[model samples]
Target: MAQMIVRNIEDSVKTGLKARASLHGWSMEEEVRHILREAVNQPPPARTKLGSRISGRFAGAGLLEPLPELHAQTIEPMVLGE
Candidate 1:
């Protein structure tokens, strides 16, 4: 088994970790080891593209009427310190 040392952690973080360990009924070191295991072994999120994901989400729903043609609108630029 390999051991690791983490140095210079902030007091607040240490306090939070200690509190979490107490909540889980484990010592701080054990809590840290468990946290590391969970962090490493978690599965990666889906890699689907944003457009495909959005389309797929509404695929089952009926399509709406065709959208009207959009007309371009101009916006006045912001004037600073007026």
Candidate 2:
């Protein structure tokens, strides 16, 4: 495996990276490698409608609760005047 060196990173950026690495249970170097891999390795997101994407995400999650039936007798039809 090849190695890469990064220099001149700001102190705040380094601190943030360290904190993020700790949160994810990784060393700073491992976090950097993970970030770089994610940046370069992801396949392009599918070119699909937003609805399709959303549906695909929750496809097998679970059944939603059924809505209660509304009182049809109390509803009035809309009256349009010309």
Candidate 3:
């Protein structure tokens, strides 16, 4: 088993942890270990791009053509206070 040391925790956070541990009938140390174990055991969420997600959502809606990408448009800066 690996030992870990965490420092500089806020007083309020420590108090909260103690309360949570008491609620679950565990020591503060046991509560922290349980929390850490659960955190590490869960799988990470998928990272999908916004464009791909939109395409997937509307895939069956009969939009077969891909949109052309716009290129090199000149922008006129706004003139403030005539």
Candidate 4:
């Protein structure tokens, strides 16, 4: 077992980690080790092109209707500045 010294930690972050560690009945070191293990084991998010996920979910939902023009240059400012 190796030891580590994490530096430059904020006071609030230390407090938060202590609370979380106590909640799980684990020392902060054990809690952090468990977290690292779980994080390393999960698969990365699948890569997809823009709108591909939504396209299948809304297949019959009217092709998402045309997205309203979001061009800021075309919109006129309704109110004048003070």
Candidate 5:
């Protein structure tokens, strides 16, 4: 049912795709279609960004030291809704 045409592909990339598809016993078209479908359907990896992933690895483990009293007091007023 696919009738749409794509344009402007480089020949070498297409050749590589065809070679890979043939190795898997699939036609280039079928392989491409499968790949497109998989790309759309698959969930992205659970963690992607470096900062969030690193933070997540140590989440709630009490590894970081608790704040000292004077520093905590200095910061607390800024956040407190008087």
Candidate 6:
């Protein structure tokens, strides 16, 4: 078993931890240990690409047709009215 000393924690944070420990029926130390264990044991989140994320957000929007690629199209600059 390893022991660690954390310093300079804000009074509010300490109070919050104490409140959480009381709510869970655990000592503050036990609650902190449980929190640390859970934090370290979780698997890393999968990294999704921006385009894939965008597609996923609109997946249920009923957009069945694939949009045309405009990579080869040229854009003309808009002329200012006199």
TM-score of each: 0.56, 0.51, 0.71, 0.55, 0.51, 0.68
Candidate 6 residue-wise lDDT, 1-82, digit = tens: 8899999999999999999999999999999998999999999899999999999999989988998889978999998995
Model 3 off-target regions past 4 Å? 52-68
- Model 1 sits at a Cα RMSD from the real structure of 5.6
Candidate 3, residues 1-82: lDDT per residue as tens digits? 9999999999999999999999999999999998999999999889899999998999989978987787897778999999
lDDT of candidate 5? 0.82
Candidate No. with top TM-score: 3
How well is each residue in 4-71 modelled by candidate 1, as lDDT tens digits?
99999999999999999999999999999999999999998889999789879988688876446667
Give the per-residue Cα lDDT of candidate 5 at 60. Answer: 95
Residues 12-70, model 2: lDDT tens digits: 99999999999999899999999999989999876999978887898778858744778
Please, what are the lDDT tens digits per residue for candidate 5 over residues 27-61? 99888888889999998977679977877888898
Mark the regions of model 1 whose C-alpha exceeds 4 Å error after superposition.
50-82
lDDT accuracy of residue 71 in candidate 6: 92
RMSD of each: 5.6, 10.2, 3.7, 5.7, 8.7, 3.2
Q: Write the per-residue lDDT of candidate 4 for residues 1-82, one digit (tens) a residue.
A: 7777889999998898888899999998788788888999999999987789877677787665776666656656788786
How many backbone clashes can be found in candidate 2? 0
What's the lDDT for all of these models? 0.91, 0.89, 0.93, 0.83, 0.82, 0.95
Cα error of candidate 1 at position 50, Å: 5.6
Candidate with best lDDT = 6
Question: What stretches of model 6 exceed 4 Å from their correct place?
Answer: 72-82
